[model samples]
Target: MTMHLALSALLAIVLAWAGLLNLAAPAFVRAEFEKWGYPPALRVLVGLMELCAAVLLLWPNGQRLGALIGGLVLLGVVASLLRTREWLRLEYPLVLLAAVALVALV
Candidate 1:
């Protein structure tokens, strides 16, 4: 249980940080989205979902829902990376997927 809580906190922090970045939509993020052929507004939408997932993850009764949401978000990321042929960038999301799975199970 302690380990589960610790991992949950860590994952929530990472998700929150990423959510903020997506919401901020800095130049690099904008450029990346543009390169991927995504509309500028998509970043804000993704950020909002991420923030929602992070909040759920932190709620004792919401972890399962959080994991489900987080998994979907990460899967979208993985699919995007695959679509863009950004092979090298796949590792991060894959790792996050594993973490999400662990959090869900443990």
Candidate 2:
């Protein structure tokens, strides 16, 4: 497969996994959201959005839109990390944002 396709697939998988975690709201997920001071319901909403983006990414003609949505979601993640001053943990989401941006562009 081409690089674009490979990257898209990878991102989709990552997003889907994350979406599942958020939807599941296990102890860590619940605690993390609580620590972030966000409303409890927001986690479910984000999860649904992430899953939608993943589905779109996997769609034959929806990669661009999926990338856009994923990028936006990652942007929010990065912003939250920065706001929370979680410097060490910020790298992963920043990398995801960059990957999503690249997917959107290419």
Candidate 3:
């Protein structure tokens, strides 16, 4: 249980940070989004979804739902990276997806 909580906290923190970056519309994020053929507005939407997932993960009763959402989000990211042929970028989301799945199982 302790390990599970620790992993959950870690994932939540990472996602929250990423979400903030997306919401802030940093230059790097904007460039990356453009490279991925996504509109600037999509960054805010993704950020909001990530933030909600982080919140759900932090809430004791919402862990499962959070894990599910987080996993789905990462899955989408993986798909996008694959579609764009960004092989190098797929690693992070794949790892996160695994973590999210583990958290969901726990």
Of the candidates shown, which would achieve the greatest TM-score relative to the real structure?
2
Model 2 lDDT tens row, 1-106 = 9898888899999999999999999999999889889887889988888998899888869998999888888888888888889999988988888888888888
TM-score of each: 0.94, 0.96, 0.93
Model 1, span 1-106: residue lDDT tens: 6988888888898889988999998899989889888997888888988888899899989887888888888999999999999999999999999999998887
Query: Candidate 3 local accuracy as lDDT?
Result: 0.89
Q: Is candidate 1 or candidate 3 better by TM-score?
A: 1
lDDT against the true structure, per candidate, is 0.89, 0.88, 0.89
> Measured by C-alpha RMSD in angstroms, how accurate is candidate 1?
1.1
Instruction: Report RMSD (Å) for each prediction in the order shown.
Output: 1.1, 0.8, 1.2
* 1-106 per-residue lDDT for model 3 (tens digits): 6999999999999889988999999799899889888997888989988898899999889989988988877887898899989899888899999999998998
Off by over 4 Å in 3: none
Question: Residue 103: error of model 2 in Å?
Answer: 0.7
In Å, residue 30's CA in model 2 sits off its true spot by: 0.8
Residue 5, candidate 1: alpha-carbon lDDT? 87
